[model samples]
Target: MTTDSTRRTPLVRLRSDGAVDEATLAYARTKIDAVLARPGLPAVTGEVRITRAAAHHAGHPWAATADVRVGRRQVVAVAEEATGTELVDRLQDRLRRQTDKAAHYWDDGRGTTAPPWRGGELRDGVSP
Candidate 1:
């Protein structure tokens, strides 16, 4: 995904596969924007594809997929839920976690002067 500095923050290109209502799409945009607007996040541009199963008896018909780039890191998250509300909720949570990890990629407790074998992290007087 390419970053567009001139565009709005959280530039989400959304696409739907079924009769998804405008309200639902708007709701998704709001949730996704909130996630992407967090502090420390890099310039992100991505797409979210929403699909609804047409089968009459499908339990979880709503599906959402997100492919986003956080700085130099790339994250792809997908989820399926029974309703639009649930779908967006899960999608935002996934996005939040993935972006958080990406934004803090350098602080993964690695490259430290002390390694785990050297009591870098001690608990109960024992190495964990």
Candidate 2:
């Protein structure tokens, strides 16, 4: 049976312009929820924040960062790509890698029991 923990994870989005329409937000939320719905994944806690980053240099395209808390650990994924096809392609590649890594880390019990933040020691700051 599916547990409630697996069903209550919330996905959140942060837009650069701070003017994201409902439709866009909904679409992003749906995509993220789909990803988190994978089997055997733990009940994720907190929301995944996706925000667009400013351009670093002239002619440089925009970038985005996805940060989320899985179990007791925080995972960050970043991607930068030019506008149009380049942007989409690059973001897809980077996001895929980031998600895969995060999934592996979370599922393999690497970050679940002994989080690296506390120097492998049990502490209040560390997540379960």
Query: Runs in model 2 with CA error above 4 Å?
Result: 1-8, 11-17, 50-63, 81-96, 107-128
For candidate 1, the 10 contiguous residues with the lowest summed lDDT are 1-10
Residue 2 lDDT (model 2) = 12
Cα RMSD for candidates in order: 7.6, 11.1
Which digits, one per residue and each the tens of the lDDT, describe model 1 over residues 25-117? 778878878888777677777788888888859999999999988777888999999999899999999988888888888344455556668
Query: For residues 2-57, what per-residue lDDT tens digits would candidate 2 score against the true structure?
Result: 11112234343334432233454444445556665567555554443333334446
Worst 10 residues of 2 by lDDT: 1-10
TM-score of model 2 (CA atoms): 0.48
TM-score of each: 0.73, 0.48
